[model samples]
Target: MTIVLIGYMASGKTSVGKILAQKLNYKFIDLDDFIEEKEHATVKDIFKNKGEIYFRKVETQYLNELLALSNDNIVLSLGGGAPCFGNNMNEVLDSSTATSVYLKGSVPFLSNKLIKKKIKRPLIAHIETVEQMTEFVGKHLFERIPFYSKAEKHVLIDNKSKPEIAEAIIAQLF
Candidate 1:
């Protein structure tokens, strides 16, 4: 079945999704990357030039396109905010033989992961202080948890390795 990973930013959805897909012998796709390729622009670029509203519209459109070709063995990593828009989450749940898995993490853990990775995450990169990072992650996670709770399964990823996290999610799916 399609394993749809959903969670807040820096929650390791993409990382775990890759490992799960490899272990399960399924195709792996990051919804945001798919949208970026289709639109010929990076997500940051889309949010920069056309604004967030326009970007979200295109995101919904792209999601619909992806879901149309449904199958049982695909793995998808959704955007952090994808579930908050319209009925996207419901549609994703209803469409394919999909399993929605929420990778739960503590606010402190998420803050540390994001800071340590030094990735170009447009959202939280602006926070230069520990207090700001904690507050930002805490508030964001709090706001997104309601949406994330809609998932079919919840896996806490406090300090797990990638393979362990992926295996945990896989075990829950079966």
Candidate 2:
């Protein structure tokens, strides 16, 4: 089965996914890294050079490609905005061989995490203050919760270590 991890930026999807995959003995694939490898460009450079529309298109294409893989034991972590665009969320939801988990994080919690790593995130890199980050995250999360809520499992990420979150996911799944 393909276990898809979906959540906002800095919500610990990639980090927790690594631990989850290790515990499950599954291959771990981060969608953004996959895109970077396939496109021969970093996600930051892709956004800077090709614009978000083009990036989203390629993102969907790669997402579909990954989802179509016949590999049974794989854990895939998606970009923050992946589910909110095109039919990506639907594709994941409709896949019989895939189970999705939403690493649900509150706006404040997510904003706090993003603020420290803002430079690494193209989407919120320009955000200057905690207030601005919180406001942006609040609005963004409001828009994304619908898509994220469609996940087969939901794991609250507040006040938990990555390993704890991963263990929670395993408990929920089994």
lDDT of 1 at 167: 92
lDDT of 1 by residue, 125-168 (tens): 67787678888888888888888998999999998998999999
Please, what are the lDDT tens digits per residue for candidate 2 over residues 1-174?
899999998999899999999999999999999999999999888999998899999999999888898666899999989999999999999987889999999999999999999997767999999999999999989999999999999999998999999999999998
How do all models score by TM-score? 0.94, 0.95
What TM value does model 2 have? 0.95
- Looking at candidate 2, the ten consecutive residues that score lowest on lDDT are 64-73
- What are the lDDT figures for the candidates, one per model? 0.86, 0.94
